[model samples]
Target: MSVLYHAVRTPVRWAFRLLTDLRVEGLHHVPSGGPFLLLPNHQSILDPLLIQSICPRKIHSMTKSTQFTQPAFRVVLAGLGAFPVRRYRVDPQTVRVLLRLLDEGQGVCVYPEGERSWDGALQPFRRGTLRVALRAGVPIIPVGISGTYDLMPRWLKRPRPGAPVSLRFGEPMCLGAIRDRSTRDRRLPEFERQLVREISRLASVPISRETRERLDAGSASPSGEGGS
Candidate 1:
């Protein structure tokens, strides 16, 4: 961890916890070392900070490219080891960077739901995210963050605080090396369903109707979460 990460982590975590009654579970599922991916849902803008505080491993997060355009915020984001990614369309460079980090045995976090939910429900994930995990061939941990939306949702300009929050890390999921194009295409939906199920279980939240429909339709929408 960088000196800045160490310097501000404790204070940020302490304040965040105090504000939201933050708690974590299934932390043992987080590997002590080596590369892994932390896949979580997006709720509040604070979700990344909350997850980073609770996660035992040092995590590099994926931030929206627009957020990086701001000089001041960009500096803070870079200091905290976050990288920018274009959310609306496919970005091959983002995939390359994520793979590089995993190949180097560093932990990375990506909110599978490309954006925060307007109604605090789970959104459909980008299919490419699953592909990345399968290609990296490392432990993929699904994280469930509850109560952030209530405290500070995307629409909420300020945090209300006092809402209880929890981070639940699911057991490591391994898709192995999915090299065959035909087989991967045929079974991608099944893998996606498995991840969605795990995330719902850990979070104790109902999957949105959109998620249900999207899964059944077997489509990867352009706005689906992953790089955002």
Candidate 2:
């Protein structure tokens, strides 16, 4: 890890540990050193800080392109292992950066849900996010994060003090060759379910029927997954 990364993670982890009743499990599932994709469900704004800071490995994650508008923030985010992705558009440069980082044996994390859920339920993943996993030559780790939504949901601007939170990492999932995008689309619901089941179990969150229905709808529709 870079000195800058260490410098930031230490204090963030410290503050979180002090302020929140945090529980972390399945550390063994995280590769001690290697290129692996980390798929975490987005919960709170604190999710990234919680996952990356508590994680033993250095994790490079995607931040919104707008977050990098400020020059100082851009430098800070880059040092903290973040790159900007234009969420609403196809950004090839983001994919190049992701692939390049993985090629260098760095751990990369992307929230499968494009953004944090409003009601603590797992939201539908944006098209192109999962497709990245298909292209990467690495194992994918599904992470379940609970309680951050309770700490601070979309309705609240500030976190509640002394809320409990948990992070659970599951075993690796490796996908074989997908015949084509159409074939992949046919199998998309299963793939989404795989993540939902693993993450929800790991975090002890119940999979909602509505969430299942959304994935079902997604399977029949043509969509894209990229980290391409």
Candidate 3:
């Protein structure tokens, strides 16, 4: 980590710890070194910052590309090790950047759910996140967050102070085990199913077929109304 990153992250970390009474479980599951991807379920925007606070090592994260266009926010984001990701479309530039970061032994955070669930349920894993993992050649650490959405749900002005939050880190999964099989077009469906199953297990939340159907039909709430 750069001197500037530590300088900025330290204060933010302290603030989040104080504000949320954040509690983390399974920290031991995280590897001490990197060249790994952190895949967390997306329920609220606060997910990224909360993950950063609990993480033992620095994490490079993908933010909406629109965030970097603003001059003031751009400076703040850069200092905190965030990079831009175009939403709803696969931008090759963003993929290249993420792959390069992972190859260099850095940690990267990707939300496989694509967008936050409006009704506080886990959604299907987008195939794009898996693509990044396959190309990056890094192990994936599945992280599960609970209670953040309730603390600052969409349509709230500010997060309710003193809300309890939980973050759980699951065992690391090696991409190499499935890479060869997934490389063949015939095995794509099986690859995606297994990937989602692993993530769901790591999350430790039972997701029923009915719940998945509901979430897929639901729409995400507007951005900025909730904490990121």
| lDDT scores in order | 0.82, 0.81, 0.69
Q: Candidate 1 — worst ten consecutive residues by lDDT sum?
A: 219-228
Q: Estimate each model's TM-score.
A: 0.93, 0.90, 0.81
- lDDT by residue (tens digit), candidate 3, 1-228: 777677766776787788877778888877788678888877677777788766878888888888799899898787778888777565777777887887788998888776776766667665566655655567777888777777776556678867777788877777563344336233334545665566566555556564456345542221111102
The sequence of per-residue lDDT tens digits that candidate 2 reaches over residues 130-227 is 66676665888999999898898878899996989888889988785464777767666677778877877876766556677786666525664454
Lowest summed-lDDT stretch of 10 residues in model 2?
A: 219-228
**Winning candidate number (TM-score):** 1
How many Å off is the CA of 101 in candidate 2? Answer: 1.0
How many pairs collide in each candidate, listed in order? 1, 4, 2
Q: Please identify model 2 stretches exceeding 4 Å from their true place.
A: 176-183, 206-210, 218-228
The residue ranges of model 1 lying beyond 4 angstroms of the native Cα positions read 220-228
Identify the superior model by lDDT, candidate 1 or candidate 2: 1
Clashing residue pairs, candidate 3? 45-228, 46-228
Lowest lDDT 10-mer window, candidate 3?
A: 219-228
Better of 2 and 3 by TM-score: 2
Compute the lDDT of residue 85 as modeled in candidate 2. 90
